[model samples]
Target: MQPTKTNIFLYLVAILVNLLSFSIGVSITWITSVIPKVDGSTITDDNPFGRLLTASEISWIAGFLPLGAAIGPLAVGKISDKIGRKKSLLILGCVNILSLVITVFAKQTVLFYISRFLAGVVLGSSYSVIPVFMAEISENHNRGALGCSVGIFVAIGMNFALVAGPYLSISVYSLLCISPLLIFVPGFFILSPETPWYLAARNDEKRLTKSLLKLRNKTVEEIHLEMTSILEVVVENETAAKAGVRDLCTNNTLRKSLLICLVIICLQQCGGIAAVLIYMPKIFEAAKTNLAPEICAIIVGVFQVFGTIVSSVVVDRLGRRILLLVSSVFTCLTLVTLGLYFRLNLSDVVWLSWLPLFSLVVYIFTFNVGLGPVPWVVMSELFPSNFTSIAAALTSSTCFMNTFIVTVTFPYLSTFLGMANCFFLFTVVTICGAIFIYMVLPETKGKSLQEIQKLLGSCG
Candidate 1:
């Protein structure tokens, strides 16, 4: 079914917002060499600790922005249901621009850390809420595509940054990351037409008609009929006091949905994607590649972005479950191979650089296609409108904590275990996660939040 032109516009909006939000850090990965060591004055790897950092510390630092970004969905979500989504997005865009400014001048490690922490907050709000906002505006038929655009933009943002970062100085790169905030170019001046459900929830039928007409390009009568389609089965939420955090847990359906969201995000982290993404330099270094760590990292970012775009093409066409499962299987093999190749003697002959390089490339591809997109998609889809505000908030918070855990620990973990062994652990976790998804996660490819609730109710 063809979506209204408005839906497509919203999809583009989602893509731009996500791309702008994620690309800043992705691009920064290339500039880490320029990030300065020994409290931001020295360029050498030498530090008082004598170990400056392992690949894991590098990986951990790579993840810090996401650690902050973890809050994006929840804090913004708490307010999005009350205020308009567009406005919430506007706040994030403005903040993104400012954060980039802070990053550009940051010299001290403390200053850079503060900049990243704030950037995390910017992403924390924009990326999480944007996808949910898109899902709300779309029907079940286009929900996956709309939602999947989150990943697509994420990939594009990373790609754009990767290409931009290596060639550009660190100062120019910071500004570039925030430039995608121009989403408000058309967004702010446009109608800001309401979602059909949002209009219905407000019980302002007259405004609902106006919003739907603008979206559907339908007549008054047709808009009314379409509004009824969503309103007929929709359950309007209670007062704010009722939607509190504790209340979300009390709802059995919401509880299960929360668990689903929680596990998927944890899986995303445990899979060590952030570690891989931010530390692409270290991954190549471990593999003994001839390329400079900075340049090799950029290549990984490029491939990661391409893989995400390819996933967008196949995502809805293939269905979420199968894609996720395939990602799990291939990811396991790739990680294991990379691990073993580095551990075992593989430098015996020329042309053997293919083994580790090929494994890392395929591993990146598998991750982009499956685990990378699925976490955001599933988290965005699993909640109903009634519970969306609090549920999304909780989900984002959980994601943030996991982000912190992985970011902080991954450095130490990678050092203790070889990057090879580190990946082997991730592989085992991902395999187990595949089993959990198969057994516990339900297919949400073509279902609205209402229909999904019914399915979950039935499962109960």
Candidate 2:
């Protein structure tokens, strides 16, 4: 990799671009705090409607975001392809700002529903486009590290929402959530350059040279060689047949890449992180822990951010497959242990009141380091350039769809099966994920985009 000092501009761009992720993280967990306040319970002092929202209505409120997100990637993928990543993101930021403004003024559930669904559209679009943008701008050696930074910003946003949501009124919290996009929209537009790949694909040599000058620290000779390589890939894509869902399924290399992406994304969501995060405060309340539910959620969120920091530092060093395997195994163990703790609670094991907090801290930390972030990095690396945008959309939409199912069903599942049983079920799913990772995933660490495609192409 280039020396750390030379990559400062690149890192800055990564940080600015990922502020979109920060907003997404806040949207995911904001409902947890808001639900109690609006449920017409003792907490009705903060209720906007001064009336009870039925459990079904509340579930829809929480579900709408992911539901909208599940639909966003399909449309946004095409938008990014047609308009380019930078412009697509700018549009998303404007839309996000508008949605949050609506949210601040919303007194009716319908308005909240509309605002959240719009936010989800932004969420899905960001996930679809951000990885491609990051991958295109990054150097081969640092791509994993930079791509994994998505989880860091997301964790920070989730932590911010958890810590701030309880203290602020709904309007105040909603307005505060708008701050990231306000910063991101202007900052990214002014400071960040378009990816060299996008410019090269359009044969815009003048702009492509300028973008590379901003993004690369290499000498002119090296930049020329890199530009040649990019142009070659663009030519190859230009000559290749158009790819679609049907084409993706029939092509061997693309099919394997897509299957890998789908499996990891499904595993990522099915491991129950989304449900855990969305219901964290409720989980603590249900566990009857000594610490306040909000406090426990905040603590776990802090650990989550820490874990992503660790992942960013070590990802390129430790490699992707190993971290994923270790994360999956340990995450499985934590969930199984957590399930056991809840099950044994029937016997009055108040002595282990701290177990849930300890278990969750480790769970969140482990999840972030590997399963949380590495899958996104791997997804970005696995696909060919021609297929990147559409493949990313398919993967992201599937991811959010799984998230929607898990988040919407968690309450009902916990009520019917008990939290212990629910966790046990998650443990089983995680174990299967671990096996899949070991048996199927190829190591992509330190590989170039071309090299990764070759590796996937060679896979039987």
lDDT of 2 by residue, 371-413 (tens): 9989989989987777889999999999999988988898899
Where does candidate 2 clash, by residue pair? Answer: none
**What is the TM-score of each predicted model, taking all chains together?**
0.87, 0.97
User: lDDT per residue, candidate 1, 175-196, as tens digits?
Assistant: 6665656555355436456566
Instruction: Tell how far residue 359 is off in model 1, in angstroms.
Output: 1.7
> Which regions in candidate 1 have their CA more than 4 angstroms from the true location?
1-63, 71-74, 183-191, 236-241, 345-349
Q: Please give the range of 10 consecutive residues that has the lowest summed lDDT in model 1.
A: 39-48
C-alpha RMSD of each candidate structure in angstroms: 3.9, 1.5
lDDT of 1: 0.66
Best-performing candidate as measured by lDDT: 2
